[model samples]
Target: MNYKRLLFCLFTGFTVATSPAFAFQELQPSDDYIQVSKEIVEILEGTHYNKPSINDQISELAFEDYLDALDPTKSFFLQNDINALSVYKKRFDDAIKSGDTQVAYTIYNLYLKRVEERLTDLENNLSAMLEGFDYTLDESLDLDSEHYTWAKNKQEQDETWRKRLKNRALTLKLNGETPEAISEVLTSRFKNQLKRIHQTDAVDVYQIFVNSITAALDPHSSYFAPRASETFNINMSLSLEGIGAVLQMEDDYTKVVRLIPGGPASAKGELSPNDKIVGVAQEGKEMINVVGMRLDDVVDMIRGERGTTVTLEIIPSKGTGQTSKRIKIVREKVKLEDQSAKKEIVEVTRGDDTYKVGVIELPTFYSDFAAQQAGDKNYKSSTKDTKKLIEELRKEGIVALILDLRNNGGGSLQEANSLTGLFIPSGPTVQIQDQNGRITPLGDRDPKIAYSGPLAVLTNRMSASASEIVAGALQDYGRALILGGQTFGKGTVQALQEVDKGQLKITQAKFYRVSGETTQHKGVVPDIIFPSVFDTEKVGESSLDRPLPWDKIHETRYPIYWDMPSLFPILEPRHQARMAKDPDFIALNDQIAEFRENEDKYKTLSLNENTRIQINEETEKRELDRENARRAALGLEAIESVDDIEPTDKLVYSKEAAEILLDFIAINQLAEREKAQQEQAN
Candidate 1:
């Protein structure tokens, strides 16, 4: 049941020794790292599906990716530094082949020098400007500088830092912070950032360089340092006693990328993917701002013994302005019991006839393979738990079902196959194409139908891997109505290889649906698409560089239980009409539109306090109006303002999904009746 095709959980650790400021020195790569680099190159060249050559072209790509990894925003490094390092752009492959990392080390040393220069400038400039900084200047700071040109000189870099600091101060000012408090926070954040940069050891730089090379091959392939590999194992096993959240460094912010089901954070349901963690506080302690802090250091701050409370200052992924909130969560082990399949029945009334639909919300396609292998009869698995839940729901007289796969990032490939088997007569479910041009068809050998009633699979952008397999299979067989947004297009298979004290996750295969379409870049498209706040331009596999392109092979024949294509014309108009009148869906679409507008407008922030405040007020008003409208539609009291609204953990999309399922049930039943009558006439 190994779901090797899913996203690989990997991380790397580094030494964090205290160092004196401005103590710039050369960092030498360990002999082991050099050897591992060679091994990694050999393995990737031999085993990777892309079969990329380590020529000047790849060397150039690796060099650019490496630079981007080091300074994504192009904030620290100057144009001179980039020009100086351009000589090594075509020499990385040569350096790798010779097992001599002098070029990489030299480039990293230069980056360190730039960082030291910037830190010194920030300390001096901010300390002098804090006394009489102008807050009413008509200026704007471009937050997204990914494509911005590097600073031409030290003077230009200083101006960049000035604007950045001004924006920081303006944000705090807008949040009702005093000038003195804002100054203190900015100083501390800058100092901590300097310390983190100083703590970057040789191993950290080596890992980044190696990852850059692998990333140039394919986005999925990566190199994990020894400590990172250990962390990866802990995350995969979900055995770590912490908040049960996966964190990554996005610019200087530690972003929450995934929330493990049954974990403290997931149970709270307030924290979401893409939310930035700015501060972390232990119980009864002052909050420490984590902005510009090392990601591993932030993780250490958040992880502690079970039952101990950790408070996080989170900047939500949605909305506009510098809005933030504090969430207190008690750390605990993520229980598998919480992740197991859960069932509920949504009662839908149409014309005085109530249709009860069973909803099986799957958090992950999990399987306790270790327990099963150890002969534990009660080994929990997604397919097994779902089958039991279906049986229970059947006994309750449920007429239809919704397999909720929203936010399910997939696990256990065998479970996906078996889960698909529950609805369709057994056949090939997914096809895997390896580096050697061999296609292997994996299927459910058993022909048992677990549930044959009207079915719909609900998914979102976060739904991926094994979830995609099940959804795609059902869609291919016309067995279930696919609902929600396009899934996370992660169709590549990775195999973990142990090297000298490290691990390399190389993309070795690609997954294709039974109908021959690969889900690499374009994920499974639902029959009825929903409006999502997730920006696909920034979120999916297609958004990433060097991703494998979508293609198709010969289709694996499978029986079509329901002709969804023929039914789409009859069903889509009805579904659209219902959504047009659905208050929740209408609110969702409005929210999405507002979110997109805010995102577009806030890419660059105005430094003028009046303009910034005006923008913030407008955003707040819009959000408040949207919330009140939704409340009114749901038969709840409307709030006066956004501040009056209480935060709740309810997922709005999930409720909308239940309504869609109701429509699906009605349409399916009517279609069945029509088919029967036509058969009688025939």
Candidate 2:
């Protein structure tokens, strides 16, 4: 039988039954939901970059994705219940395509019932479970839900919940909460979750279901319900006030996607991409657990008036997610000027000579398009600002320049093209390939160069999109030495398309460099690698599910300014030797190595209270020792504890970049002199 036709037959005349008595509410799909689902499918099929076929394979993938979205931790829905719903697994494709979402509602209703039953059991037996926990016993709870199968029965699920509750209690106890305080916090958290359950509506269910299907296509693509669309619009209009971090639901946690450049979180330099926000608290209020809360509700709790404070308890992505840290940020309107490119000059001593290097830190590739379109000559743009800064640096007699693009989560594409033009004399900067297979090369048509002296482009894992374009173009043209870690690899282009009710953000194009290398999953590799504070597995586009693959196309014709490849042999060995001796770099490498070692151990948490405490202490001790070691090497006073160490305000990365620039200038100048001597001899 044809997969599509079979799916059609399966959903034809299929109606969802009313939710069980224990459910929070009798949730059902609305009339507009059907229209919206159909519209989403049509848009995805006709316009999406992949142009995937609607079939049983897609149906199965979407069904699994939906189940994971509903109960990522596998805490609800027994194996028997899953077996009962397995009949509709291959029918989602037709149901979504034909505007029949009864199957989706059916699954969601069952999930709600399972949730109520689990929460009810946990609430009724909370005291008994707490009292029964034996902290000395050698027991543990596997937090990685993928390793779990659905519980065979209610009894099995109860045992799982018992271990979970025990682990939660142990974590709280280790954090200095007394038994009484722990009980109160747990009770309040459970009650809040129960209240939120009752508030679930049809739109929320529809949004999740449709998004699950879209996620099967690509991680960046998603469906936004009407309410969500409104919020998205408000944020885009720059009218919403908050910490300025973009967040998304990752399993049962709200993971930070990217910190908006110049936002409170970005400016504070504490919160970053891939950090899981597990708890939220208002100013002077007790922390509220948000581990399993809806993304919308969490956002509401985090949102507040400007000048207010919101505290977030986050599991840092750089470390194993076994421990968490709190970060407090004051809410503010993210001003456009705050994200603009700025310039500074760093003086580095190399043996007997001191070299002056100009540094430009671009938080984002931004342009005042509204002002520019209205014929405002003084309109703010990254390229214009950078050009002016370059002229000023040249006037000051700087010998080298470094463009710092770390944590620059991209903005205007045109600005990226124009910025790349600053270093090269007219060349193709980037290439765009649309879904229809048309390749468009975007470049700097102007034959003028701003500053063509020794240059380096510094990037990190957070640098993405427009940042990748600029870095990749300059590297391809041999115009600059690319430094730092691999970029964030967000090369796919997304656009918001209007549906019947809300909107669909779909991936429609891909970005490529002049050398024909696509920047989709394999972002631009730096000429010299730096020790990254970010874990690549936890960050970047490759870390996402169903990400587009990296490929290559025909390379565009472009001119190379300097032969960077020939100089790498001379520069790389020096960089490696210097980094090997630098105490700060040594400490960073050791810290990252320790983080990798503990990654496996943190996958499963110890239910034994004593063991958990020991593990946490070991982590803290290692961190303190590393910090002290680095301080001692730098001739600074060692701190007694990690808490006593203040956040260093120094620009270590910029300083290292300046040193690298000095090496490049000396090497290139010596080569030029030797070439002139050879010509004279000839």
Candidate 3:
């Protein structure tokens, strides 16, 4: 239910079925895979949070999901293939339970055949199409084929392939590649795709089949192949020496989903979320086009020894065009120095008085578990680092503090509890509900309060899991003002169990805040909400299908440190007035509105070359105008063109949140002075 878990699901490689046996030889599922399938089913039915019955309905859904997994774009398999595989739709549950995976293997074999046939067709047709393709034609292709039925026959499949190939060629042409270059690239990309397809073995198919079953139970529940399990561990540990960006496969493209806060990519500030990596090259090596490479293979290519350089060709997520840029980065370990909690001081001028507010940016709730096990007294952790930062800030004469947890996809539940202990006296931080409906409270064991000053917690849509736990606990205790958009709402707990040669990541429990609110589908709502570009319907847990619902439990008794709810009414109007006059805030709102509008307009693209070019130009111009407007409002010079604007020039909503923290500091100071005056009178 966390971002890493989602990435694991996307990045885990799976194979699809091809046609009947003539095109390519069929590989049958091994006895080992069959045995593992049986074990997986037993575990899911017995211990999974849902405890779902493997009935006919579930089997039928799994069957359909398996088909979709194989031919998601409906590019390879024909209607005849679907018909041939339909016989197993109602019998998958029985087969899985009995350790009879013949049907699954049969489907996989068919898929392999279809892929072989498609590759042959593509190779045969590429030369002629590349030689005589007309770019100026007023033609378009519906790239989103989810609603379309499977191709009725081979002729229909051929037509679909032709359109798809033409679209690919047009995309390259739009990017200014020469015809000869386009031909070579397309030929190589297709050949590599075929080679990867051939590399899919029986274990890969077994993982895919079992995942289809687990995915039916819930989106978070999955079966990771042995190698995939290793990938999952690396993702969770964040100790690997690499670029420090989370990669996932989307529509055959490896995408940069997130950049770890202190990683090389984040430090360089060149890579961004949703940017597609089409090609990767080693230091002083020829670039390899990774368009259709397996996620594991691509990861291997990106990862290397520390202090090594890797270059990436990135297709920007913006607009409907295929423009790309290259970025080179030196790999480094995601060390404590990069991921550990960091501190800064911001001086705010209110009328004549200057107030210093300390800001602590927590990238993750991380801890050196190995170091602790090794009995190192200096083991690094979020709580320890945060405590030290607070002490340093206190010595520097700070009035208030802000715990910035933006984009922190959480880690270590123990760290979340200990981090909450840093602010408040002993109390329950979060509660866990297991599969049998047993609720267990996880409280802050440490009685020491690290800092008791006025506090605010900053969050965004990406603030998830342990981040939600910490923010929700602090808010529930009335110890800190929660500021920003709602958190990511990932409340479920997953446990990885080794089954035979693979791992089963099953959802075993759910998380609840001390105040009895579940941070599942509905994440923690900030006391003071800020403007965000993320669409809740598209980005949060609520957007996911079959997510655990939001619920409540009995509230725990904890003493409130401050009456924040009572103070919000007085602060809301003042904050609104400030935002209305602030140029940066105004620009942020305008940009958010424009973003929403563009999202709606570009849901389906005009594939015609001229129309696509025009749309891209318009989008670029609009973005440029918005950036210039923001710069002018901030008393900075406006750039004449979009190309002149650097990546760091992009507007950040956190600056507005920081300003709010300053307001909070000033108001709290005024209240404390008034209280002192009253005490003197008494």
**Model 1: per-residue Cα lDDT over 421-444, one tens digit each:** 999877999999999889999999
RMSD of 3: 6.0
> Whole-model lDDT for model 2 versus the true structure?
0.85
Best TM-score among the predictions, by candidate number: 2
lDDT of 2 by residue, 290-406 (tens): 988999999999889999999999887766455678989999988888888899999888789777899999999888889999999999998999899889989988998999998
lDDT-better candidate, 2 vs 3: 2
The lDDT per prediction is: 0.82, 0.85, 0.80
Report the Cα lDDT for candidate 3.
Answer: 0.80
Q: Is candidate 2 or 3 superior in TM-score?
A: 2
Q: After superposing candidate 3, which stretches have Cα over 4 Å from the reference?
A: 1-23, 143-148, 154-156, 284-286, 640-654, 665-682
Q: What digit string (tens of lDDT, one per residue) describes model 3 on residues 1-682?
A: 2343233224332222331345344566677766787788888989988778998988988998888777677777788667766767887898789887766766776677778878877887899977766667776666454456789988887777777788777777877888888888888888888888888887778777887787677778989988899988887777789999999766668988678879999888778777889889999985678976788899999999999999998887654433567889999988777888989887767789877878899998888888999999999999999999999999999878889998898888999999999999888999999889899999987788999878889998889999999999999898998988899899999998999987899999999999999999899999888887667876778876578889999888888877887778877887788778877677677767877766645545454778778877887788788878878877899888876866431224444555676767667789999999999999
For candidate 1, which ten residues in a row score worst on lDDT? 5-14
Ranking by TM-score: 2, 1, 3
